[model samples]
Target: MTAAARLLDDVCHLTAQSLNRLETSEHFRVVKMLGEGSYGKVVLAVHNQSASASVCPGSPMALKFFPRATTSLCSFLREYNLSLRFCTHPSLSRALGIAYLTPSHYVFAQQAGLFGDLYDFIVPEAGVEEDRCQRVVSQLSGALSHLHSLGFVHRDVKPENVFLCDAACRWVKLGDFGMAKARGTKVPEVWYRSPYCTPEAETARGDGDGAGERSEPEEKKRGPRVWASVEPSVDSWALGVLTYAMLTGAHPWPQTSSDCGAYLKYLHWFRTAKSPEEELDLWAEPQHQGPDGTPADFGAKEQPSVAPQFARFTPLGRAFFRLLLNPGPADRGRPEDALGYLGGAWVPVGERERLEERRKKSRGGGGGGAVNEVKLKDGRGLR
Candidate 1:
């Protein structure tokens, strides 16, 4: 049997056992739909277990449901297993349970985020706070380190895949491992991939140029194929992209009519650039004119410019971006390197102390009793 077929068989056997255990488990209930994607639909749920009763009315949970026809059973099983393995980490989302609801469908459950995904937190005028952004990068770096240590690569690492555990945006967790795979595996031909894909992935897929146009000799001379075997470095590349997006309300590439257009431009630039620094310089440079002979900055008034945000980054931050964004997998920075560069503290000790103090003050009904909620551009809570 094929690997996928074997995995599916194992999943079926495991699901059958889980179903038997779930018969007496009547505490879990779906609350509302959280979001939907090509993989499946995610919903907010509550488990009325006695252990969690003291904390809140219902123990909040996030449940992902995949229709057997629409989603690959093997992919679902992969994510379920990975999440369960890494869930103990503070920065990694935990898998609560998994079950096959019917022969045609399956469901996976986990702890729900109070705020939501990172995309919901992004706004036009103002982006996430600098401290919060640093915290997120640090936390995610730790999470990536853990995953890399296990010899896995989270192929998809974008804003939408990251979840915030609290309203304050103090704790962030990496989620959605459906696209994850073992290191050195052949990259899958996923149609609906994140725009934050690395240069290697783009090149391997022949993203910018027509696939048939490139000859094998030219490809060989150019070094590895763009869609080279998947590596842990792809996650690092995505971390750089995600950091830029969070700091600025824009992508690192020039604005395009569609995400695909921008992604193509990103790939083309990376393909031609001599180094990661050169690629970053290209993104930092302002566009001059378009084919219509009109200034490309016409829409400046509508959206916040990424240039200013890029300017605000510290020297260490800029270096970190360049390191992770390197086109070559070998040159790319590891998660541990990022953690060290961000200050050898996985969760900064001082920050934790401050947060604890705030919580204590709130509990005592002090003047500063409100939770330090992170606000969106419109001055609304991230929730």
Candidate 2:
């Protein structure tokens, strides 16, 4: 049997409630793997005891299991504690309890996002409909604001890390706290560093592309070696990127940090003063052209003189992007600023209703949304 199988066999029958009492961790009747990542795997589990079950209401809880070999005790504790500290907020997944079945297995239960993560909803290239995107921005922005107020920053904030609570995206939660760090603490550069969204690069520390070393026992090579202060601005920048991505299928820039042309173009679009070298670089970059020699990608028809990237979003969307992706770390606005745009036409009501129609067909469906007939795998839900 595999390590996971051993773990399941060991704890599937226990009714314990806390970490020290693994032998009594409830009798988990069913366990189905939901997703897996480098850190560990998340499984949807249901204990026989309903009232004592993790309060997911009508659904089973998600138990993310980490093996001792992969997740260090220190790392696990930090993530667990931080998650619980912010559990009071509706957008942050609550850590119900923890258990240590063996040196090889450690597990923690939390509210499950049965509808699946936000990445599933994003339509590649075209992006999500406006109202859907707006809903996500609203919930996640609030979550980030709450975390920042606590002086902690979720260094990694991308769509893949966000879980949806409903089909129309009216409710969502930002998951994966493993990369979250307290501001001012020098942490391994675990954030996505691409031209599309280089919040840390815009800051002084990561600007030079200095990689930091990981002090872990092994596999410390996941991110760049350069360590820098984890600030709230990093999350803000990520929100900007997420917003842009959800609004427009394409990223603002490519992934490489060495692309001078991409960075120059972005800077120009942002209206930041470029240095002499940057100006020269922007000048040297040639315009994209088609076989007929006309401009390959024209800017928005409404604003012919603007950058093509600006064509991706509406005027309101652009303003929201700018607010979250200010030039400097401290210059960025709070995530709550997104709440202001919630009433705007991120997507028209007519189209948003149509989008809602399609979401009803989703297999995973969602909670309390247009997806009225929530058909979960375990056949558990409200009629």
Top-lDDT structure, candidate number: 2
Question: Residue 81 in candidate 2 has what lDDT?
Answer: 59
**TM-scores, one per candidate:** 0.64, 0.70
Candidate 1: deviation at residue 60, Å?
2.0
Tell me the tens digit of each residue's lDDT in model 1 across 1-383.
Answer: 23543453466457546552242137567777887765668888776663432234477778777777876656666677668655567989887754446555677777678688887765432345556777888899888987777667787777677898885678989988876776777743322233354554543343333223447787576555444466888788778877776655455653211345654544454454334344335346455743433235534531132233232343345556667776567878887777655552212233334434544444465332111233321122221
Residue 261 CA error for candidate 2 (Å)? 3.4
lDDT of each: 0.59, 0.60
Predict model 2's lDDT versus the native.
0.60
Where does the lowest 10-residue lDDT sum fall in candidate 2?
Answer: 374-383
Candidate 1 clash pair list: 203-226, 203-227, 204-226, 204-227
Per-residue lDDT, model 2, residue 299, is 35
Residue runs of model 2 more than 4 Å from their true location after superposition = 1-18, 21-26, 50-59, 188-199, 202-226, 256-260, 272-305, 346-383
